[model samples]
Target: MLSENKLWYQNSRMEETKALLLQARQEGFRSIRLNLFPAAVAEGGVDAIDAWYQSLRVLVTYGNSVGLHMIIDLHESNRCGVDASECRRLTTDFWSRTAGMFSDTRFDVSYELLNEPKGEMVSQWGALYPQLIKLVRSKDRHHSIIVGGKGYSTIWDLPPADPDQERIIYTFHYYNPMSFTHQGADWLKAHPSLAERRNIGWGSYADRTRLAIDFRSVDGWRSRNDAPLFLGEFGVFKRAPAEDRVVWLSSVARMSEERGITWCLFDYEGGFGVEGLLPAIQKGARRQP
Candidate 1:
């Protein structure tokens, strides 16, 4: 992020994104998800945003060249939805101005409406989602849009999407058994209870049972939502024990595959690599119906 120039995306950082995407492809992944932090309206007008998009176009072009589809996520807009007026004012405008910007771009770039709608945003999502859907559908029909449930896109209680819309995929982030997955995560530990959740063991019966219950919720949501679902983000932090992290990852991977829901790991080099796409995972996923 080059804040000095006010462009959220910089060419240098894009190099890293590109390198990660290439590494993902080499490891048998075909698509990458990129997060975006939209500069505030106070920052600039259409000209400024157009400049930002121009920089982004270069990166998407490279992604297309390498046979990858990129998902552009609105990383931090969930909070805006708390104030109905602000949510309507900012989100609709954001999508309206930029959704068409990439229509003619040479790559497949999908728009993700919001990152993780927490607190008021979750309960109020139904009030906001349909409007954004209408706004984006009008601008660009060629690209797909990804949306997620509340509770930070948790798998429980997925809100059903309108039936009229097409190419709208549901997404969720997995950090189940937060005690185990988020162990040693500084941000998560700010609350005293989470601070004490570190060093939880994996591969226990309780751990497996928790996995089963969480995935069952996901399965129920899949059956109810009637739209394509995506496992948007799921990873165990690097601070956790390596064997436990792998166990958690393999469990989630198996559940997603068994149900035929596609997914993306949280990151490549950051943490939770699953032994760099172990062949056992690939072969197991292939054998699933």
Candidate 2:
């Protein structure tokens, strides 16, 4: 999924979203992640919910025509300072409406139920996921549902499937050894120095086998037996030296391809833009600098 900043409703004009979508397709991206919310919905309640659906109808139609798959991400429902019950209700209601909106569209679409659900423990995610999945299934049975575990959807939190539901795919974000990937990110508490040299634990080949094995180890039993993996989000900040970022990214790409895992770099613009990584990524040759 191409990581796009929240641009719901008029915050991002249709023209802007279209332009970005075109650019993303040109850059070999087939899917774009978007958050759905109506500005008045949160405060206005059910009536606002209706407005949100009307907006989504327009957005999804535009996205489909351009060949960009839409991954409707339920972001900010957990964070953005909302209470848990409110967040959960808004999220559930949104999906219920969303599934209905795209019920007949030909577009390749999927639902990422929530983005990086916060706090630790699988119980938190486990308690609500089955119900949310049922809601989505009720509206659209065939579309794939991407669900993440708690503690920011780290591999460690991935949960086992119900054995009944087979259409869902397990998803997780990867920005391991945060010191390296998040270098210079302002939101991070302490950024790693530009000159620092960090090593990915896999070492040497940095191939898919290592990645799969490493990821499989995160939660021990659950990830190994139950979930099929998707590296939902991963990218380095632009402030990091280009050379370092490229090396890390190459390892990610190689590993992803090897494992048959669908991997997407974290974003399309800002610190993680394709323009920033193009030179090094194009080389497709790994080297130790």
Please provide, for model 1 over 1-289, each residue's C-alpha lDDT reduced to its tens digit, 9 standing for 90 to 100.
1112233355656677667667666767677777665655236777666667776777667777788887877765545645656666767767887687777646588888877866567667777888888889888888898888766777874678667888999888888777777776666534556555667877788777888888998777766667888899888877777767766777788888878888877765654444365555556445433
**lDDT per residue (tens digit) for residues 3-44 in model 2:** 433344443565686777777777667777775443335576
Best by lDDT: 1
Instruction: Assess candidate 2 and give its lDDT.
Output: 0.66
Quickly count the clashes in candidate 1: 0
Q: Candidate 2, which segments miss by more than 4 Å at Cα?
A: 1-8, 36-41, 44-52, 77-82, 120-123, 189-213, 216-223, 275-289
C-alpha TM-scores of all predictions:
0.85, 0.80
**Lowest-sum lDDT 10-residue window in model 1:** 1-10
Model 1: CA > 4 A from native: 1-8, 40-48, 78-84, 269-289
TM-score winner: 1
